[model samples]
Target: MYHLSSLQTKAIAFLLTLFSAGHLSGQGLKNYGNNYRDFAGKAYYFGLSFGVNRSNYQIVHSRQFIGNESIKIAESNDGPGFTVGIITNMKIGDYFDLRMIPSFSFVERNISYTGYTNLEDNMTRIESTFFEVPFQVRYKSKPYKDVKLYVVSGLKYGFDISSKSRTKRLTDQIRLSPHDFSVEAGAGIQFFLPYVIFSPELKFTQGIGNVLIYRNDLQESTVLEKILSRAFTISFHFEG
Candidate 1:
């Protein structure tokens, strides 16, 4: 049998919690709209979304890290990001849909090494503009008047458009792969309006592949065995 990674499991749990809370809040809403009927018959719809994110790297230490003389602790620091995307949603059933969101995202990730060669702690910052596409399966609860609660699980592929790793040799900083794949999950609330359907969402993404481009000659790269990307995002989507 296939198993879920710890990150994937946590993402699922988070979404479930989100849905539970949102469902409760939705039930308390006294005013309801009949506008949902307009979208109920649509097979597909397109929309746009804007989001903000917090992103970081998940690092795994190598065996060599123990014996290393240059560094003691290597870890990552989280940074803020922004994203804009176009959403294409296809209805599959009364409560299910398939969705694709292709976005342009800007983020910065940092790595810090403690006790670096008897000097002060060293930090490396990597900035990226990612071309990200996520394909999602959405399960929405039956409408509660004008509001509906939904959860989505998906796989995303990302390529860093701002990466200079291809054009220049990286000697001072840790190098990363320009592209990666991730597993993601999220929750959202949809509100039917007169002109558009508005949805606000929370999402988590964890990379499946190691982004570290290991260089034996570099202590920064060698101190870590693997590097995975992770992000938490908040987005607002408008659909007609």
Candidate 2:
């Protein structure tokens, strides 16, 4: 069974309590009216985002990794990353908006491999500087006082501006493609303050294609078949 860490449990409990309080407050019937009436009246708005991400790869090893006598084990480890972005939101309906965020991410991932007869493990660390653009459709719930809940679903296109595939010496290195596409989904709660809207969001991203560039000369690339990217991001957005 997968267990939540103590910190994660506490965080979940806190959010549940907050959501419950907001829901109860909304049911009191007394009109607590909207805070920023003019904010939503605008056709479009811009914002800024700062966030942290936990990134890793979902590996689908080839038959060689399992059945071949020369190969022992192969796996990947998660790494920490950060992001910064500019947010552009276009109002489409009373409850809908089109959102575009162009961002840069600094991420790292590690993969380890072992041979059948050798007890030693070889680990390869990959660093990617990704330029990403996400096109998302956001659906918001009715405002309860000054707070509202929203869900977003989207597609993201990313290019690794610092991919190692083009490096002169690729012989012993694990290489990845410069381009990738992913599907993304997330939910957030918005707090409409006096001057700006503050939102904290949690999102997930999964790659749609293999990002690995395989080379036969490299043993690190030979034991693997497909590599897909996955990440969980937590962001804070501020909009005027």
Candidate 3:
């Protein structure tokens, strides 16, 4: 068996206690507001999502260097790609819930090499696939028995699991260990069913930090290099 240190055990205990207290308090509040407890339940949802993404280099007001080369930054797209994820809902009240989603997505960018010596082409295409997790707080309008609208705000963390690239004259592939974090916001509608609930949601996500690790050199780069796209995702959820 794995043994936890005293401090670790205490931290775990504290978190569990906090979680239990919050759950119990929510239950008590629901009981007191019995008239509004119709939406209290646990649900799991899985769905397919389609979206567009763009990637770009982070531009700094100050000049930066890569292997003694000075480069000017610009943003570009590799192209549109697809996304899919599963979501779990923890109902807190008639108007509030917690949502956790895990997803796999593809991002791409066409990057142009500017102010670089011995580089042949002006641009190349880079594509990457990511595994992402998002934690969201959802607030719903009053449930009208069968239909409701909700807004979601959250943070997402993503890891770049793989990447590939191709150019007009050459194809180069590399494995990147890039990680990303973002804040997301969106709204959607839900239709309740006897055994399942269906929700279609739209979300927008923006990166919170520079996504690149190497300044301009692609050969020795391990970072994602650029953020190719801001995405608009239309996701369908089946919850039960």
Which segments of model 2 are wrong by more than 4 Å? 1-34, 117-119, 164-166
Clashes counted in candidate 1 amount to: 0
Which digits, one per residue and each the tens of the lDDT, describe model 2 over residues 42-74? 888799999998787878887666666765778
Give the TM-score of each candidate.
Answer: 0.88, 0.85, 0.62
- Clash pairs for candidate 1: none
Candidates ranked, most accurate by lDDT first: 1, 2, 3
User: Highest TM-score: which candidate?
Assistant: 1
| Higher-ranked by TM-score: 1 or 3 | 1
Tens-digit lDDT track for model 1 on 65-170?
9998778888888888999999999999887999999999999888988884557588888889999999999988767778888998899999998777633754
Model 3, runs deviating above 4 Å: 1-73, 113-121, 163-177, 216-229
lDDT of each: 0.85, 0.79, 0.56
Q: Candidate 1's error at 126, in angstroms?
A: 0.6
Given candidate 1, what's the lDDT at residue 187? 84
